[model samples]
Target: MATRPSSLESGRIHHQLGKPRGLLVSPICTSRKMSSKGPCRRGHSSSDSPCVENATLVPTSVRTHSENSSLIASSIGATEVVSQQPISSNVENLAVSRMEAIGQSLSARGISQQVSSVILSSWRHGTNAQFNSAWNRWSRWCVQRQVDPVRAPLADILEFLHILFQQGLQYRTINVYRSAISSAHVPVEGAPVGQHSLVSRFFKGIFNIRPPQPKYCTTWDTGKVLRYILSLPRNRELSLRLMTLKTAMLVALVTAGRCSSLIALDLQFMQKTKTAFVFTLVKPTKCSAASKTAKKVTLTHYPPDSKLCVVKALEVYLQRTKPARGQGKDKLTSLFLSFVKPVHAVVSATIARWLRTIMASSGIDVSHYRAHSTRGAATSAAARAGVSTAQILKAADWSSESTFTRFYRRDVTTSEFQTAVLASVKR
Candidate 1:
């Protein structure tokens, strides 16, 4: 039997006091005088319970069975999650709960690992911000329309997308919205269908998205663009500033160098063995170069005496302006600083703007043209020069010959016209 105070001293005790009305007491005791009241966690009596305005001091989370209250808590690291109610077990709630779990999983890894998780999640769940926005709008629309969001057919999504496209959203932006719907894993409200099913149905024919055309600073005729670039203030401009930007873009125009790969290059990156100063264009810096950081990181000026003129311009800009360290020290060391001053490289936007200003000055109305027009012009120039379509593809870094044949290789078909004219002459 449990120990108990003497019935004569304790108001009443069952068995111990030999009284029929006596009851077993909890660790937090109450006298018969205050019998109607419950004992609190701290063992304090009702009149002076040491609580605030009749509230219990012990957290609701630790309340016992008699209180009929719920307790749910999450403990991680230095965090203490406290709750006083039961969690929902419905599918919608479960999906949200799982997302939080995935987020926590990502938070514990390295940056690359986390980025991989994000990409994977996006493939499965639509990670793009634009797509998320579209999903939200559609969700709200569904609620307003009284359509069961869970059982929404693919046609519903298409209808919503059409409405959005008509609202002046770009095809790419609309596509992003459609992409977000791809992440729908389960029915939103759990009617009869899963979200992925609806998504698959909705997106069966929808993945043809293109990125927005970035704003260019200037636009003009191809000839004007070239002239303006060639006329850059030479000594006043960084030495070879014009040459570097022009060559890089020209190379990008002619060769289709990735903006990263092109910008990450220097004269040293080339081979001095070639007469035209040809060098292997390697190391697109979207990711850091591994295994070559120590030896290949620095610029290798060629012929033992020639400093890349473009690299010289970069040195001048660095000494003059003291540009800050960027994501890649080796890559940002490009000689072509923006004419705007303080910025490191001649960015695509800046190049486009430069072309526009020069074209406007050179009597070309370039306002309607785009930076990509320069790319178009390069193909036109290559075709006019009778450069082999294959050579153009090689210069451009195209992945597929078909793409090069379709877009970059524009050799004119003059043979047919020539043949027809010759036949007439012969006749």
Candidate 2:
């Protein structure tokens, strides 16, 4: 009965407590309070009624119900902890996404840098300088207009072209400006100026309006120029500067060498043979691209009595100048050195200026002639000397006869014209 008395006792004492309010108290908790036991988990004495005052007592049978309610509250708290897991997971996912985006950005930038490096390496030295100049002008124009240069609209390009045209820029210079604009937009912007229909149409109209003018440099007569150069007295009193100029003229005239390739000549590349001297071009010429096999110029010596011999002139120049330190030592180790203090390697511009100085000294008006005229003069002379057209082409390293006909062969077709005249007279 004592064990089963809790249910009835709860019903009988239910009216004694009036209404069961506030916290539900289990029979175990009630018993602990009733008996004079140890202190509660809150560290309060059993004599203190305040600790038990808020708690309402219930029977043993209702004790199971109180336990079940407490178990439900615990389960709810566990569910809340579980719910919080997804928020942390979402935060982690957001951080991961941001990291991935940063990685992709760096990867793209690295690829762009690699592409820019390859493009720059492909350009020739002089061409790179010219492109930089063109790009700088375009950049300044865009800055003045307060517009972006990379994604510039087609209208902007057209306006820039109009400005250049009004400024009296040549047709070739205008084309270069277009090229610079196109290069600036492409790669990063994914748009090239050449692709625009409006730009293409405008260029076509420009070409039709102003046909390209054929610009030619007056031919330097090789025979008269060489004769005058040889007439200059060869004495110890002659400066190394004059000797250098004389050697340059003789080498350039005999080899028909390009001005760009002439500055690249080094003493290490030249070898004296029994009958003649051979010069090995280290870098490929503008016309030639094969680096594995370089082109060589073989100059045979003229008679000992002749002071006009290229081999003799080269030998005299070598003897007069101080010997260069053996091979591959410094950048200034070029065969040609400047006459100034702390002599440096001469560039193509310097070589061109030197050629003009020689022509001026020889009493020729060089107002209309360029340094390249030396190549034309040399090749043309070889053509007139009954040297086969094929041999002349070989000496000049020309892949096509068109360039020869257009620029080098400026002289009239005398043989063909004479033949036609004789036939007409006979008839």
Candidate 3:
């Protein structure tokens, strides 16, 4: 009988034959030192050295595409087994690919790997999706013209931006794409793409042509929504779904909190005081980095109306959902849980939908405004009630008054301008 080829020889043949579609092969016999007494760490025969045959095949779905790419690139002639960790979000994968591209570009410049990692780490995770989108578009544009994306001439960059402008993109959105390019491309004339004199002037011309405007000119009255809430039956008599919507709306209006902040509320960080229920956000919010301390939202008892009391509604909701929360370690700790079976923590988008539902039910024009308009409505109502600017700022977690003035400040009475104009005209 003919002698069998060694495992190492088998692996090479397998690799040359090409890995099966949608599968990744794991490397075998990683150790260079062989055991004299018995098989090596991989338990291969002494005659069988580290080679292709020892590799095991795994499904591609087991690892994220970006992670698989990184592992394959790092290993030399051997495919390492990737960890079983679940794939991350699309944004995270995009971030990995962008960093890898940046690393490859820097490697030719004599930059060390550790320093490149540090440089990549400086970018915020929140901006990955935006930067990746812009970068991909720029790269595609460069490819069509047969130019290097990172080393393109200044005229090419300007031409790309001009094309974006022609596509009816707003001034601010185009500026974001510019910032994305600046982060990736090498500096032009010792200045970033955004800072270049020609680019700056081009942006100024664009802004002058199409000025930015606030999303809402006026916000609906909060009293209208409260009146609708008060009309609902007592919390005990209402269905779990209705109660959940009511509770979410009341907390949103009272706290003027964003959807992200609302979803970040966890029962683990909640406290019940003698007169108020306090919730502290454990997850990161938009302002988390700006403020050193954790943000707190306090809902106090409403002496004027027990039925409309947020604290009371919240307590009743928790009591109603107690059975659904289950028990012990597996119990859900999130403040908001889905009202359906197999109930679990709700995402930020769910909170926004609930708010929008409440707005529609209360007769607010959902077409002209969104769930986020609740912030402007509540703050405007508070201002009309003579609440100080400082108190409004503190409650809304706004660091500057300018933010409120530019974005949140709006006429509480909708159609005021139309009413005024129509009233002045003769019938």
lDDT of each: 0.37, 0.52, 0.64
TM-score of 1: 0.44
Return the top candidate by TM-score.
Answer: 3
| Residue-by-residue lDDT tens digits, candidate 1, 99-191 | 332343344344455575665553221133333333444443442332323234555656666554444444444555454444442334443
Instruction: Locate the minimum summed-lDDT window of 10 residues in model 1.
Output: 71-80
Candidate with best lDDT: 3
- For candidate 3, lDDT tens digit of each residue in 12-71? 211111221221111111122223442221222222211111110011223222322222
Query: Candidate 2 lDDT, tens digit per residue, 184-265?
Result: 4533334457656777788887878775443453354454455466578773445888878877876777767778878867
Give the root-mean-square deviation of each candidate in angstroms.
Answer: 26.8, 40.0, 19.7
Candidate 2 residue runs with Cα over 4 Å from true position: 1-109, 112-118, 187-191, 194-202, 235-237, 288-292, 324-328, 412-427
Give Cα distance to truth, residue 382, candidate 3, Å.
Answer: 0.6
What's the best-to-worst order under TM-score? Answer: 3, 2, 1
Q: Superpose all Cα atoms of candidate 1 onto the true structure and report the RMSD in Å to 1 decimal.
A: 26.8
**What TM-score would every model get versus the actual structure?**
0.44, 0.64, 0.69
